[model samples]
Target: MLLAVGLAVGLALLLWARRRCPRGAGSWGLVLRHWLARRWLARAAGWQRRRLEQACKDGPRSQELLLLEGAGTPAPDAATFRERHPLTRHSADGTEPPPSPRPPLGLWALLRSCCAASSPLQGSVLYLDVLARAYPEALSPRGTARFSWARGCSLPAAAWPLPSLYCAPEAVGAAPSRAAALYVQLLLALQERALRVLEAGLLSELYDALATLRASWEGLAQDLASGGLSPHLELPQGLRHQLEGLLAPDAARAAELRAECARGWDVIARRLWPRLQVVVVAEPGSEQLYWEALQESACQGLPLYSPFYSAAGVLLGLNLWPEQPEPHYLLCPGWAFCEFLPVEPPGAEGPPDTVPLADVREGQEYELVLTAQAGLSRCRVGEVLTVAGFHYRCPLVGPVRRLSQTLSVRGEGVPEDRFYRSLRRAVAMWPGARLVDYVCAESSLMGASSGACAPHYQVFVELQGVRDLSEAQRYKLDQCLQEDFPVYKSFRLKGSIGPLRLHLVAAGAFRELRDAVGTRGPMARVLRDHRPLHFIQSRVLS
Candidate 1:
């Protein structure tokens, strides 16, 4: 019994050691270290290594030195390396001898050597070549060609042929025997190192390139400002001419140069900048110039980076553009409006007492209230003002009192109160039938003969039912909708609303609410008012 217990304890200890050292004892680690050192030592003396050093001195070239070194030539240079190994390289006759196999080296060691090498460019090129060889089938023809070129080989226009040489210990040909074995080993080592260097170097280069491009752009912007390029793009021709004259020495007679710069900027902006969409928020009936500029920017692929409307754009361009909105706050001068009291005049001492009419106050806290006329019939102009301790006009709308309108299905004017009331009534009729969501799709009719308004609205409704309803029941529901909803009736009579449709949601449509709030209750309790519920409701209902 004691002997059995001893055996069990010994087994347990062995298992624990194995778990702690997955490579099996320190022996494997030591072997790997030894192999790495041997490979590096071999590489240092290899022809490929010599060639790589030569290429580094020569500056950037198409040949991949690292690949040549990894392929087997001692200190191999990119210029001498071919696409295929000697064994793989074949003459038209297909009588080439099999290439000698080289021992595999760990990736980590190879990378470390390449990165630590003397030449950054050569190191990068060599590393990329090795990576391609290690995963030969994974790369594309273009990728393979690129790898070869970077290594220093000027490939012939024809398709790559098998290598004519081979490393063999017992061969009866003109091929060198001992040299072949050495070459194969050297090649493998070089390839391993090249891969690591490529990975690290590529990332570094990408970041550096981006930074340089951004700096260039900023410098150009400064030059343009001094040269008199107005930020507003509304500068007079005389001023612009003077600015052009000032920039004549550098930019004159070089329209194409400016265009080239713009193209370069566009390329970086499109390929590297984070978010590209630019959104312009303006009052209804506002000019379209802003939208045009935004569209132009998008076409150039340097999309307008606006946060208010381009949330997806922001997320997609997270790497390149500022994720937040540009001009995060707006400033409006107080003289522009009479709705709010002007605490102080322009250039007044101390912080403007009240607030300048048109000046924007960043980080200022204010309450937003939607006030209606006495009868709650119409939203009065200047009614939606901000209130800190005192009332202030919102900078977003300027001083203009813009009235908001709701469109009926038939393009008739529908009061906001009536629309909300109809929705409330619908919910009341069937306690189980809840009016969950809504949206208005805009349309327009052109030409005077059309007798239609410039803009039209189509309503979409989301309804929740206790149980599933048949098509016939849905028709009845539509009728109920028309009768109870004034907007629906007006739309039907005017042919503004194409048709009435019911979007029925599943019984568990409120599941999302449960998931979000970690509990179940009235959805209204979870989602704040004014949030777009159409999308969420549609998913639940469907």
Candidate 2:
């Protein structure tokens, strides 16, 4: 009897030690482990709800916490990544994917949790979306929510089960999954290593096309100043197609155009164009323009998204965009996910000093760490977000930039979000001009002394419709950039850095970037999705 009892105890310890008997552990390990992880996750959720309830127990208003669990996701501990990088150089055949995010082989199950009953992690659907793509065949949604969860699953390479907001469709490839995956890998490498091709100039034909486009824009900008704006101008068939592709990124013919870019200037002149779409040409206030565009664009289908927006909707009340009034964005509640925090000294780890979420001051930045009912004790997601405001005593925050996106060429470190905002404001100074694509790299400026070169930021911009502007017009933006971000601008003012030069390129520069660094999202993705502006292109803009 004792011998039998000892065997039972040994089995129990083994199951616990093998992370609840995860896949490859034994027969039925995947299914049984997943079940155990789910059970633990439920228990953690209850504990978290209790903690929130306890925190609000003495308040005048009761703290209302909404718990949203994505159907059939592994417990938070089931699967996790140490870091999330942008692009990679992978084989075009799609036979392999960096081995880390390998296509799902078995079920996802949270084997353990560092904070099982300590705190509740919000955004279960967020992780579930990821898992679905990782293991499409295994991790199917148990129930349907009002919104579509796995909308990106239809795409070739970016088939991961992530939400539509988290990915940009322009980067994904078009057909046969492997090729698409390869395209994504190329695009990622291009974006990640943009500096490699910084010195290469635009081919002669490409240069002429840009010059012609600028000439046309010069005429248009002059007309706009004199109050003559056309609703939409007729374009030559070829020019029209290229302009359309640039504006609607996903519309471009991926394979043919990418091959042509390598061929020569003649191919670019034949395949691409000079002109661009005039999105908004007003001095200020583009409300009218946006409304008109929205009216013209049809709502063809209902958008399926993950629970991030749903959770946000729950945290605050659902606020719809004026243009798309049908669907709302929400956050998925429960389960800890990880992101990195930009600490003051930078890159040091171990429990970032965070004020209680209740005590967090608005506009102040803090490292975000989340505890889950899964494997992670506390995970870092490598993002810097700001507390915008409060949502019923909870802080409302939004991501600002990634941890690695800081550029400090002259000891003046400027974050990508900050830089992107300044450039945007600079573009906004002109009416009807569009800032198509941009890349900023550390370039050596002619030094203060002869025979010396100083490192400065060289901002390469591809503006399709905006031509040359007067000193006065450009001067208007200088003040806005300085007043707004001031760090890089201050370096410029102090002569510590050279004037931030903007180099304009022909259309399809960013398209080249998209083709080079393959995107991790679905093809035909939402056009306005967040794109990392730092080094997402490989071709030089001149």
Clashes of each: 58, 48
As a TM-score, model 2 comes out at 0.41
Local error of candidate 1 at 249, Å? Answer: 71
Q: Return the lDDT, model 2, position 138.
A: 23
lDDT of 2 by residue, 217-265 (tens): 3333332233322234433344334323322112123333344454543
Runs of candidate 2 with Cα error greater than 4 angstroms are: 1-306, 309-334, 337-352, 356-364, 370-380, 388-396, 430-432, 444-452, 467-479, 521-541
Show the lowest summed lDDT stretch of 10 residues, model 1. 309-318
Q: Candidate 1 — which residues are off by over 4 angstroms?
A: 1-405, 408-410, 415-417, 436-465, 470-491, 494-496, 506-542
Cα lDDT of all candidates, in order? 0.30, 0.35
Residues 312-400 of candidate 1: C-alpha lDDT, one tens digit per residue: 00100011122333322121111011112232323577642222222334334322111111111111121123222211222432211
